[model samples]
Target: MTNATAPLDFIRPEVDRALQRFVDRRRTAFDDPDLAAVLGTVRDFLAGGKRLRPAFCYWGWRAAGGADDPGVISAASALELLQASALVHDDVMDSSDMRRGMPSAHRRFEKLHVDSGWHGSAVQFGEGAAILVGNLLLIWSGELWRNSGLPAESLASAQPVFDHMLTELMNGQYLDLLAQAHGENSFESARRVALFKSGKYSVEHPLRLGMILAAQSREAWIDQVCAGYGQNVGIAFQLRDDVLGVFGDPAETGKPAGDDLREGKRTMLIARTLELASPAQAQSVRALVGDPKLDAEGVATLRTVIEDTGALASAEELITTYVKEAVAVLDAAPIEAEAREALKALAIAATTRRN
Candidate 1:
């Protein structure tokens, strides 16, 4: 189902109001007219995301019995700002020109280069501009969190979780880069990447941070439970993304079909395919995987080969396993019955999402 019709659609509107305020404040800080363009880029990048991270933060606070405090709202909104920073950087790293069916921040800058007839290499200009904008978003995210009207103790308690999330994200990005370079997309390696990159930051840490800010007495146990839930949901999310990358309709996904094959992403599906392929099939798959020149027909061939080897089924099975485990974790948590049921629904929705 579309996010507009999803159960949590109301949360997105609330978050959007906060985000617009944040963006206005951001634009007011700069005196240079050119900087307005930069701020506009940031605004565009922040728009249209699923806002899943912030929603998780909100739910975590509720699960811990936090009141609907303004501070909680601000803190949750900061998560989306942080996510925008990451996505801008990630798009640059991935050499992705388009995001959410529009030019990425870097690509927009590059296009301005050509449109304005600016001197120098557009590629370098775009990369440099996008990096600075990403940094700005990161800094503002921290500022939002610090100024969220939370008590000093609450802020202090949540700081470490936020810090570790960013650190882990960087480390996870590095691991993904290394894995890509070394062609080492084993199941174990992919699991680690998912945990550090998406699981912790995308799900667990956000939840834990909200819980910490709420000053829940069972924070320790809750953190563990959140981690387990995040691990399962995060991996499931990534696996679905991989499937979408290779097999989804381009019109719906807003990404080129087989983009992952073109980028040579060493996903779990690819790893499993290689492990289970017959000798000749394995050789054919290996030859096509990292070749930048692999065409649409080649990608289709590879997809068929992968499916024939049962890798697709294996990946789907793993997703089911993780989702089941995550449900169990939530079931055992000490949350209020109503909040627990809502959290369970969220878990199911996140893991079973089609887009």
Candidate 2:
């Protein structure tokens, strides 16, 4: 690939600068110290993500012959705000205690309530404050995107995609909740949840938004890329995440070991395990998977069940198949050479990371 710049090195600092400037400007508009604490917590949470969405957006623009432009960088950086908003809300939804090795937004707010001896239920206060913080980030994302200095026509062209992505995300989130409520554990149901909840927004829409902004119109090839390469990579990316949620170290993943098991997330891995497990194995999983007090021993037991069921191997194979198909599409795509190489590397990075 001839030393193509890694997106983390090339794009993250610029995105960080844009985010910092946005935060500074917003700080001036709000004077309350309590609000400042909320803002600061969100800001710190923003600092830790891999910045992969912006990277995909940038490469998609590049693939469409877009030049280096600060306007586009600013526009792409808005995705980080959108991501932060999702994570803060997601942590609350999952009741996750930590994020990026620190207290999650809700937990932090809950602690604040307790420490300050607030006159209300600390748990409710924390969750309410985190929801407001998430909403604030969502509002700021729109503001940043609209003010990104891109041409009005380009932004206008991409507006529908940007809007649709958010709609899809909300729909996916609700579907996920519904699946959990109903105890739906079929692989097909799990795949549906993965596709809408994380896959499409994480990859496909970001790529489409970037390409549409650059091309200033929809193209047949853009749709093809999104549907083929984008879709596969997105699903594979989420699958890889499901694996990490089970097997990754807390020091690296920034959540408790087997956090997904504790959350009772109906992920593809869990679905696959149930499909392959013996009656006793399935029974053990059913008993242990949703227990909030799952300790290292419980985690170890579930890990053994998942491993012995061959579900882990099956999920890994699926990830490989998806990545291979995505790469094959990229190989035949008529795009900029740098973008082609970068996209290939991105596919590997997305699916193979330990955390």
Candidate 3:
């Protein structure tokens, strides 16, 4: 058999090229130097991603008997733009300083403000500019999807899924904010946030959109495939991310070690830790998890507490369970054999990645 990841590797360059062409075309529409800087930032931001969403969409189309087509690849690439928009806005909201080993959009803009000696507060200017950049990416994602050179009827057939995916993503972002503001840390709340914010848009909706576009309508099996395979794999993917946020390497993840803990993200891993922790351990985590000024020792202390409480183990078990569930679904799915193997590989890759 071909390498497990060959399918994803095959599509990545195609998607990147599509993104470059789209951005280049957009560049021709604007002439301002400041706008050029914004475009450059967007281009750079769009450069780094796993492209998992596009991979899922592509394989979904293939499974539905869609032949190889550049137009399909173009449509799939739009998901990367959507992903970029989400990340830029997420960094601004979280006050994140770095992403993919570079200064985040807001921080970059903030630096520009400082360097230019702008009159207003640098922080506010950075955040405002970053928000506008994110909005531009979101708008561009839609435009790209609509103008991907696919037939109008096929695009229309899949439009609702795309619309709903965006809606769910926004709702998930709000839910994440609310979870933090209200200090809601239940497993259920964490799962809900993961489902809307990342999981649906990350996997289920993308897959469904691809299938719908290929099949030219929402078929019965498409819904089953998404529900059975997409949901479980997506949630598992997020759970793995929760583990990485606390434990992943900075070199691999492209962020500071323990950055998510510093930002006080109410992730499932944290919720599970609190659930299983001793009173003293829970108190310690509560004191340390959200401290923006947390030092290496503080991070070490939390890591010990999470390990001692067995939350890490529990999270791993859940991740394994979800992936197993997804694999079982894939085994029975009527997808083309090659695509089935590719998706199974993707499920493992998504859940077990270091970054």
How do all models score by TM-score?
A: 0.94, 0.98, 0.98
Error of 1 at 243 (Å): 1.3
lDDT of each: 0.80, 0.89, 0.91
User: If the candidates were sorted by their TM-score against the true structure, best first, what order would they fall in?
Assistant: 3, 2, 1
For candidate 3, the 10 contiguous residues with the lowest summed lDDT are 1-10
lDDT of 1 by residue, 1-355 (tens): 2332353574688788888888887666776877877977887877777777887787788878787887788888999989888878987887876677778889899988888899999999999999999999899899989998888888887888889889999998888778789984677887788678777788888878877788644356877878788778888878877787788887676666777787777777788888899999888888888777778899999999989999999888988898889889988888656556666666666666655
Residue 188 lDDT (model 1): 80
TM-score, candidate number 2: 0.98
* Better candidate by TM-score, 1 or 3: 3
* Steric overlap count per candidate: 0, 0, 0
Q: Which model is ahead, 1 or 2, in terms of TM-score? A: 2
Q: Taking the tens digit of each residue's C-alpha lDDT, what string does model 3 give over 229-295?
A: 9999999999998888889998888889899999999999999999999999999999998899999
Clashing pairs in 3: none
Question: How many clashes does the backbone of model 2 have?
Answer: 0
| Superposed Cα deviation of residue 60, candidate 3 (Å) | 0.4
